[model samples]
Target: MSSPRRVTLSPTSSAASSAGFGAGSFVVGSLGGGSSFSIRSTLSARACLDCFSPSVSAMGAPPAPRQHQSEPATRQSVQSPPIATTAVFSALVERAQTQYAKSGDRYIGYRVLGDGPIDLLALNNGSNIWIDRDDEPHWAHFDRRLSSFTRLIRFDPSGVGLSDPLGAGELPTVELWTQDALAVLNAVESEHAALLGVSDGGPVAMLLSAMYPERISALVLMNSSARIARDDDYPCGIPQHLLDRFVNTVSDPTGGEDRVDDLALLAPSLAGDPEFQLWWKTAGERSAGPTTAKALDTLATAFDVRGILPLIRVPTLVMYRLDHPFLRPGHAHYLAEHVAGAKLVELPGRDHLAYVGETEPLLDEIEEFLTGTRGGSDTERVLATILFTDIVDSTKRASTAGDRLWREQLDNHDRMAARQLQRFGGRQVKSTGDGLLATFDGPARAIQCGLAMCDGARQLGMDVRVGIHTGEVERRGTDIAGIGVHIASRVQACAEPGEVWVSRTLTDLLAGSAVTFADRGDHTLKGVPGTWQLFKVEG
Candidate 1:
């Protein structure tokens, strides 16, 4: 193997800049021998990989990314929110619009999110879908952490999810999957990127890295292996009889009806959780059908990337949970030993899935490996829905009623609000003088509570304006503070008298709920960084 030649990709087009990618040069390299050259070229009118033009140079090491951090927050009251169902979560967090990358005659579905410096392409195991990912909080949080340090690209492999399914009698292969990945890369004009492969997706990442070293900057393999099936020389692989049994299980025509066994093997920690089980069954069925699942599984058993493992020349990180039943520590050991300069990190857990159990430690390792910093902070942050309510014209109402009468009205209002908060499972953060601030685990509950406040206020001969927004809030002891808190406050200020107004984030989470919303249009919230789309909760 020759010294890997470096390639530099510069995004000079206005379209690229507008898409949140900064204008600059980034280094990447190929393992194969190639003379260094520079060319400013636009992609031709191809059916599949149409996108911006990119200028390439000899690949080299990528630049270090800038440090990113969350804002500090003060806390007043704290309580954990209840676990929500998938139907509610899907609408809570907004989704990235799905786009297609043409690979040969077939279309590959992909989506881009975050604007971090490095482009990290997530190659999921064939059984997962991008749209269904938001259904789980852990998975969504994992993606957000990755995106916080890199521009995250997620896509469906050929014949899975939103991508065109494989033809009848056709089989899936690593080479074909590699093409699907490359098409997505071209579609986004990302000449260089780090690859994060989970489960069976790891083999494809290894092959792509070895085959086109210039395009790959780094490789991270999580709970994956070079080859899965056992043979005489590879005693660590799954035995033939067990592999056959697993294949037969997935090929069952009953589909998602009985996935408990599958969930147990994949994520034992979450197997007992009914909500997680429902999401697993639904996401699996939506991800791939019985035939496709079997095909992917059959192909996976045949995957043997050991021959190309030594050919990989880029920075590599091999991560595996120590007790993952099937993936096991041996696979990570094999990968770390074979791949040159590979760093192996063993995490302690029983779940094979990356999103299950304690995930922050895994995320912490990946962040430190890629960015040279753990970026840990003193304050804790979590995803939550913030609710702000204010009594309309409080001063005037007080003047009309006098101090004693106004005090009585305030007491009645507080009692009413407390009852609604308790009923909805919300924690009141503090009193906002004329109103109150609270937080909920789910947006649907927050909105419902806000509406309850409005109705309760009307009974007290007072009007109340309520606002709600969902985002990452910083926990500071007994209070919560962050940009998320500020956004909710501004949203409340924008509400009309006796109306319950919510940020678009709230409405998205409540999409399939019985509640309906009328668009209040986009407004530039005071103290907030961007123009937020607001909506009114219909009575």
Candidate 2:
């Protein structure tokens, strides 16, 4: 027997477990790969052929791998995170050989392989704690396929995974989450990289591309949604009702079977890849315990990033499975349409994982998109439901309220507008002075939110006009530009105090909704060419 090493606790037991987990015994069940399937075992292509079993062999062959599976499962030498970022970034640290940064507990995990040049970030999907198996150390198939061409960096976001624990009050919204991604990129000296996001990781990818387009070469989104809320039209996606249920479930101590199953479904591609399956299961179980429900609740109720799709400037491949139970192809379609020149491909298989399931076809598509050999395919169609809103008479209001008081009132206005936006499933762009600019996933939500905001402002003793238009817009910094923003602004200008008005585009997008709009007559505005049919918000 060897001597035990003394351990230190940094609140992220998951990361600390790296030292704690040195055991090398491998185990499997009825579904088994060949006995040669050790984490470090070197399999000849012939050996892997039989090792993966006849079923996986039929699916399609994977790319060449560098390492053998005979070696015991263990973390490769890499840096770990410090105590602070540890709470927010767990997985990266626990398995790291060294810390990325020594500054105030903020750090990220990184692993360099393949050739230099491009950096690839692998964001984490939600992995609940409870799984205890050491996966990568024992999984041969994964080590082989992913070891080529890509320099992969994986990290734990706040409050879960192997990173340190977080304060209950820390808000992990899309913006904050994207901040973590940016921090990782910056820490690793990556000027640019193609982002690959899975499940909830999709929103982070979209936001990163939007905020830092120059830094993202391309994006690969799998089984993700811009909005956490769902509608009757999209059955498989996460409905708002279901999100509420999820919040309740995550708080459970046992990490309910439903939650586990729901997560397992996210990577259905791994169902047959026992090695990967084991790794995923163990990673999730080790991260957040059953009580992490509150953290899950924070994400489920508040995570909405639909507004940033139009801001994307990098090449992208938004791939979604036809039958993904958590997030459907419709969301993927929405993403494809929103991003300026992104591509959407629907292929065979119902799995939500890119590494597992039928990956060859996916790999081929990725290769094509990344190389631009597949060509620039303008797959985006004009969607009629995006609405833009900003506060009116901001110049006068700023003058009246003065710097301090006016700033406070503007803050209040922004808060009210954002709350309404969240309720309506709208996206909040960066704030304009004394106003807010936002886009809704649906026309109904846009109209409803406009009226609500205007009315809410009245109650606060401030009069405001609301304008909304649904059309494709060019992203400018945190705000939107192009005809859509102009039309919405013009609509707001046309509105009388304490009223909401929308352009004809918004009216047409409302056809399917129970809500209706009353004609406000044709209006021509300053600098805006052509007469626009306008309507007042009505029940």
Q: List TM-scores for all candidates, in order.
A: 0.53, 0.51
lDDT of 2 by residue, 130-187 (tens): 1222133322223222323234454555544545555554434444455556665666
Model 2 poorest ten-residue lDDT run: 25-34
Prediction 1 global C-alpha lDDT: 0.64
lDDT string for model 1 (1-539, tens) is: 22221111111211111111122211111110000000101111221011101100100122344333332111121122233445544443355678898986899887776666656677664433465676576676666666656666777777777889877666666656777777877887776655667776776677667555556667777788877766676657766656655565545655333222555556668776777667666666667666666676666665666655666666777777766655546677788888776766666676767766756656555554455321121225555679999999999989999999999999999999999999988999999889998998556678889998999899888899999987667778989998889999999999999999988765544432346799999999887777889999995
Which residue ranges in model 1 land beyond 4 Å of their true spot? 1-95, 127-130, 255-260, 373-539
In candidate 2 the C-alpha lDDT for residue 381 amounts to: 25
Candidate lDDT (C-alpha), each: 0.64, 0.50
Q: Which is the leading candidate under TM-score?
A: 1
lDDT of 2 at 519: 91
Cα error of candidate 1 at position 289, Å: 1.4
List candidate 2 stretches off by more than 4 Å.
1-96, 101-105, 126-134, 137-140, 162-164, 232-238, 254-260, 267-281, 291-294, 297-302, 323-326, 372-539
